[model samples]
Target: MPRTILILNGHPDPSGKGLCHALGEAYAEGARTAGHEVRRLDVASLDFDFLRSQAAFESEAPPPTIIAAQADVLWANHLVVIFPLWLGDMPAMLKAFFEQVLRPGFAFSYRPRGFPVMHLKGRSARIIVTMGMPALVYRWYYQAHGLKNLARNVLGFVGFAPVRDTIVGSVATRGRESIGRVLEKVRELGRRAV
Candidate 1:
């Protein structure tokens, strides 16, 4: 079935010419080829304040970029986030993007008794994380902490269900062939629209 997909490149680098960015493009290509409507949000290109102050969150109106991003999130049935793990976690810019865009009332609302009401329901997400360490090490030793944080805590909390992830590691030492293989895998995932 055709679906609306949003690919977010969360790399902090403004150039958008790295492994993460390539993976995002590959995914977008496959998704488009599969007849899905695709939109991309390059975090580094957005002109907005990353630091969210108490007043900002309390403010009724958020920045225009954030509002626009929220609209995109609402438009997409599937969200694909491609980012590099820096210092065993996501880049600060990516974190800031979530902090600014996934605001209260937009992504969620508090409930009197139970958990907060998730507004971004009926959506699925895929997180593709690139790291310098071996993939097995990150999965076993670190227990995929970063992936769990985003998949469960952030996206799942907001009602993105069946959240899936792909971990690509040893990126720094990977050759062209290895990178090509990874890109192909990501493209296949996109083709499935999963």
Candidate 2:
């Protein structure tokens, strides 16, 4: 059956057109071509403080819009995350979205013993990350695949199954052929995504 996908674009500069856009464009087109319904949530366009006020988190109220976004997260069958890796990890807003949207009672449940448990089962995800650093150096020095653990452990803890991680490495300055190669890979990933 065709699935419904939620595409989360985490890049601040939508028009910059690098590996980040490569991830977003690929998955959006790929899911569409595969006959899946796609809904996009671009982080850069959303307004609101990335930090929920201390009072809001502690007591009476959090933003209603955040509640709404959580509802959307629940609706998606396939979650596709596209982003650029900055300072060895996800952009702040992207991280903040998880902090805000993936709430305690929504994305997961906790065992009475105090650990969080997965709840959003029956769904799957793909996280595609673009990095400016070379893959090897990033992995060796900076632990590039830590994002994979975020997707696999954190998001997976929220119940997404079979979470796939794609890293488009070495995105700093590139020659024409190299740029073309990355774009080609993006297209290929899109075509293969189902």
Candidate 3:
């Protein structure tokens, strides 16, 4: 079956040729070749302010950029987020983008008695992270805390089920052949719509 795939190029750098950008393009290419609809958002090019207060977070209207982004989120069945791990976590702009788009009432709503009501229950996500460290070190020694936080605390909290991830490590040092293999692997994932 065909799926609607939203590829978020989350690198803070605006360059279109970075590893994250290449990976996102690869995913979109494979998805399109397989007849899946694909849309992409380059986070670095978007303009939006950070949520600084509880009032702003709870009640403020989102910027136009965010409103469109939310619409994209709503339109897609599968989301592919590609970013470079910075200081062990996602770039601040990408995090802020999430804060803007996944606002209250859009992503979830609080319940008086217990857990918040999730609005995105039928969606799924794939997070791809590029980092300077070895993948095993980030997953094992570091416990992949940042990745887990985004996957479980944020995406899962909002109702995206079976959130998955691809961690590409030693990115800066990877040879062209290795990078090509990684890109091919990501493309296959896109082809499968998983």
Candidate 4:
């Protein structure tokens, strides 16, 4: 069956030349080839302020860009977030994008007591992280903490189910052939709508 998929290019650079950009394009290409509806959100191209206080986070109206991004999030059945790992975490722009878009009443609602209510229960997510280190080293030695936090803490907390991830490490050293293989694998993932 066809799915509504949103591919979020989370790279901080807006030049459309990064590996993350290529990966996102490849995914969208494969998805469209497989008969799926695909949408894209480029974080670098958006203009929005970062939330600085709890009151702002909970009550302030998001900017127009954020509102539009939230609409895309709400429209999709599946989400693909692609970013380059920086300082052991997602780019600051991507983090800000999440902060601005996943506002209260959109992603969840707070209760006087107990856990916040999740409004996005039916959706699914996949996070793809490109990094400078070996994938296994990031997974085992570093414990893949950043990836886990996004997949479980943020997405899962907002009710995204079965959140999965692809870690493409040693990106700086991968040759053309190696990168091509990775792109093919990601394309296959897109074809499967995973």
lDDT of each: 0.91, 0.73, 0.93, 0.93
Instruction: Give the CA lDDT, 0 to 100, for residue 80 in model 4.
Output: 99
Per-residue lDDT tens digits for candidate 3, residues 140-189, read 99999999999998899999988999999998899999999999999999
Model 2: CA > 4 A from native? 14-18, 52-62
Better of 1 and 3 by lDDT: 3
Off by over 4 Å in 4: none
lDDT of 1 by residue, 38-154 (tens): 999999998877554776765558779888999999999999998999888899889889888787888998788999999999999999999999999999999999889999999
Candidate 3, position 134, lDDT: 96
Better by lDDT, candidate 2 or 1: 1
Alpha-carbon lDDT of model 4: 0.93
Clashing residue pairs, backbone N/CA/C < 3 A, model 1: none
Model 3 — which ten-residue stretch has the worst lDDT?
10-19
Using TM-score as the yardstick, the better of models 1 and 3 is 3
1-194 in candidate 2: lDDT tens per residue?
Answer: 67778888888764645567656776778767867777888777766466656555434344776776777788888788888887778888888777777766677766879657777888888887777777777767766666866776678878888888777776776777887777667666565653
Alpha-carbon runs more than 4 Å astray in model 3:
none
